[model samples]
Target chain A: MSDPDRVLLCYCTCPNPASAQHLAETLVRESLAACVNRIAGIQSTYRWKGEVTSDSEELLLIKTTAGQFEALKERLLAVHPYELPELIAVPVERGHAAYLEWVRAAGGD
Target chain B: MSDPDRVLLCYCTCPNPASAQHLAETLVRESLAACVNRIAGIQSTYRWKGEVTSDSEELLLIKTTAGQFEALKERLLAVHPYELPELIAVPVERGHAAYLEWVRAAGGD
Candidate 1:
């Protein structure tokens, strides 16, 4: 299997559907990403300002290469409404050759 | 030094927050994961019925050992309202010794 480039997996969440869709399409259409998988129905529990809080949020798993990450972050923040967009990147170790190829074809610089 | 059993990563989403939290708790309370990191703001796109469709989904990265996966899958489905819960398991190659140790300690049969 042709090893896929170690993908940078980014995570994010939105309170409303419009912002979620908007960010996803913008990332994909611009070719900064090979693919963008949006997931919803997240109940988040965490400490904010030293107080425990819980909220319903939608999470996004973004797939891109390491090279484009900085720019991707900039783009996400430019449009994202949240005070702190959950932008974390993980490395893709391996994947089915065909699937990774599809990702590469889908990506744009 | 101890080796943490290779973890199984399961991805999921809930249309509503209740389902998300409910499913998460069931899995964790039963000790299916060392930890469940909840995130939000996801916008997903995929092809369904020959048409490209998109929606918001909260992807749950359920961290557990490889052995508990079968049971984990069963429990997630039992509590999950979705027809097909997005349950995909990926292996952990390496991790910090202390963190993996916590995972092992957190596991339950």
Candidate 2:
């Protein structure tokens, strides 16, 4: 099981700005994320179904607490356009204390 | 100690396109990173030195292996202009297998 209070930076990619924006808003509105940074115009290259595919995708850096990850993942997989969306959570080992505390509180219980 | 073979996503921010591009190129060229995705025009808000600050910055999503992290961190701190640059390494628990392999191989031993 994931830790309940650890700060996490979850990385997710969307096909375009519309989807990215929608997802970001949903996460924040639901208090599943403290904040979401949308970075547009990223080119991703990876292997898919035995072929190397490259495409333009927008990246979402979602900030939340670990306890929210499961719910966040569920919401993402349910609403995301991709059949298999990438949701990778990386722990925040060190960050500004005040900022991290804000994230934990803003992320909700 | 970190797991040397694990794939890692290192989050970093640059003040502008020139710096972001330069840092990305250097990391890839030096094998400190397998790939670096430059996302321009991001706004970051955080608490710094007892004050809350917000700034427009470019984000660098660096892909490398844990083995290269220390060297990568050293290089980033040495070259990054900020008195204290943010270098957060998030371990990749899951990824496309081939892509992860590419990262580990390209990141060097």
Strongest candidate by lDDT: 2
**For candidate 1, what is the recovered fraction of reference interface contacts?**
0.23
Model 2: DockQ against the native?
A: 0.19
Question: What is the C-alpha lDDT profile of model 2 across A3-78, one tens digit per residue?
Answer: 6888888888899999999999999999999999998898554434434345678989999887888788888887
Model 2 lDDT, residue B99, Cα: 51
- Compose the digit string of candidate 1's lDDT tens values, residues A1-109: 2234555567788776678778887777676665567556668998999999999876667767666777788999998998987888765543334444555555543
The DockQ-based CAPRI class assigned to model 1 is incorrect
Regions more than 4 Å wrong, model 1? A1-4, B1-43, B46-109
lDDT (C-alpha, whole model) for all candidates = 0.67, 0.81
The TM-score each candidate achieves on chain A is 0.85, 0.95
TM-score of each: 0.55, 0.60
Model 1 TM: 0.55
